[model samples]
Target: MHPTTPRIAIVGGGLGGLTLARVLQVNGIEATLYEADINRHIRLGQGGTLDMHAESGQHALHEAGLDAEFRAAARPEGQDMKLFDKHGTLLSEQATDEDDMDRPEIDRGVLRDILLDSVNPDSIQWGKYLKDASPLTGGQHALHFADGTATTCDLLVGADGAWSHVRPLVTAAEPDHSGVNFVELSITDVDRTHPAIAELVGRGSLYALGDNKGIMTQRNGDGRIRTYVAFRAREDWLTMYGIPFDRPDVARTVILGYFSDWAPELTDLIRYCDDTMLPRPIMQLPVGLTWASKPGVTLIGDAAHLMSPFAGAGANLAMRDAVELAQAVTENPGNLPAAIETYEKALHAYVLPVAEIASHHLDLMISPDGDKQMLALLKQFDAMAAQGSGGDR
Candidate 1:
């Protein structure tokens, strides 16, 4: 479409989608973002915190011209991380460097709001859940929505996250359970109401592991301690446990039974949780998955490579993909097919290491010798940090 406006449609208003829209807007390329949420307030408690890395998330934010906003909202102290075994003995703790912005933390909702604010309000169409995408002539596709509305776009980008409907267009890989499930719970106003747990968790993340099971907690930006009770079990194990997720009290009691031999301090995580629980089954697509680029369709973020959160690269890679794809389109303008080919090639190479790290970390974190393995890994990281700083500790 030469100098004419290209009808680019981005499905999913996630960080990647929003970042793509903002970066394209910065380059004078207007694109529409179709979000499934009814509105911005659809989920007040969207998710937990995210740490943006310099090479990915922060880089994308800078490209989108939101560096100042991101810096203002990021929490440097949230980088503090502690690890322990089931006995409640602290294995290793990493103190945060107040001056380091390499991986600053931000709440998922806050980051999303920042991205949303930077984009053109008219470009986001909320509540437009994609139903199907039909290929059309001239490298265009028609998007059908659940609300009986349809639109056509010259370029269709899917940043819709795991279980994406758009992934089928490029690859047939489905997300398989990673042999782990997390029962998520939280304690509100933890600093005051649950001082003990707050102190145990510190300002950032804590991992207590043993017996092939684990209890993980991380402090959110809102002073709440979000906890995940993880089990290396079969896909239907939680359902078979017969614990009612709706009744947090009973569920917490029943869940604690599995960890009866664990230290009381560690078990307290589940004991003092608030009256809400969510079952999260970890799933991941085949590692290093790639596909031949289609004429008018592409994907980013979890849609492109769905991996477990162990590597802490999911969000970072998503934003990185957004920046790369946006720049590809900006550079190639009228030649979208070439742009997509270039973007996909770079994307495949970029995501390979991340996927491998995520897979390896998940295996180590949940294996029988997880505690020893994790502690050794932390010591190696400490040694690397010391060496990088020209010091030995």
Candidate 2:
């Protein structure tokens, strides 16, 4: 390791990795980011919406000097949420004002563009699919890529996602199925072509949960309605269910069979989806996963704590981790090991409770009485908010 400036390598070009690189550069430190994507354009229109929490995601952007850009692109009205049951009974609805920025929503692709544009294009090595990473003497690491090329750095940060290749260097923990499966579908030109769905989904998100199953939909900025048909099933159910996923029409019919008794309004989402269907199995690491602090290597975001999307904390936490890690490195100066230890300790402490909450929410939403349980939980939250407001008054 260099005594004054340690060589930093960030693997994975997700929000966390990109934020780290941008923040490091803002602090006058240089780091190389390696992403598997062939180019930045490949991520366009690839991911769904993300709500940037004020204290985490937004704070990270502020640290990286992209606050103005993020604010311009964020949608405060996208905080609107509607909850329903299988019978199309509206259980609860929360609508946000245009100025409500507590957790403003933004398209994932747009957020990535903001971070990408903030960093120097020359610092990013696109198409570098990391094969593996090995430890070298004196707290350094050698990153081997799939293209028969390699690089070494004094500090290695794995911002890679759930199946991070660099995670094994620290902990043996792998993500396990959370018993929830999602069939993702989308409807483009939603407002123009699918007026019924646009009306049903409202502005932001609609969640219809019942019979241990769910149909979740969100309106994207590009006039698309992205939906996830989620249900509790065996990890291998998608493979064995015999649905012709490749044929969108046949797959839609087959999928609708599961929700035959569901309301027409909720089932129409699947009936009018585009030709793409993506099957995703929710996976999670242990609630309080931790590892012995290894020098030159550490993890952030999903690489450290992979949880179901129930809590909606994945991206927020990833950006928060980036901010914390960058601060640790910049504050610790040349002490690379100390910086990693500090960041890991803080990450573990903060992520434990969030992981547990996410696990609990996943269980509640996938149970036989999911709708009833969710309604009760929402009422409890309302009561808590009322009490807090009363006390403040």
Alpha-carbon lDDT, every model: 0.89, 0.90
Question: Candidate 2, 212: how far from true, in Å?
Answer: 0.7
Model 1 alpha-carbon drift over 4 Å, by segment: 1-4, 389-393
Q: Return the TM-score for each candidate structure.
A: 0.97, 0.97
Native-to-model Cα distance after best TM-score fit, residue 75 in candidate 1, in Å: 0.7
RMSD of each: 2.2, 2.1
Model 1 alpha-carbon miss at residue 156, Å: 0.2
Error of 2 at 201 (Å): 0.6
Which TM-score value belongs to model 1? Answer: 0.97
Pairs with backbone N, CA or C atoms under 3 Å apart (clashes), candidate 1: none
Question: Highest TM-score, which number?
Answer: 2
- Residue-level lDDT for 117 in candidate 2: 94
Q: Which candidate is the best by lDDT?
A: 2
Q: State model 1's lDDT.
A: 0.89
In model 2, which regions exceed 4 Å deviation? Answer: 389-393
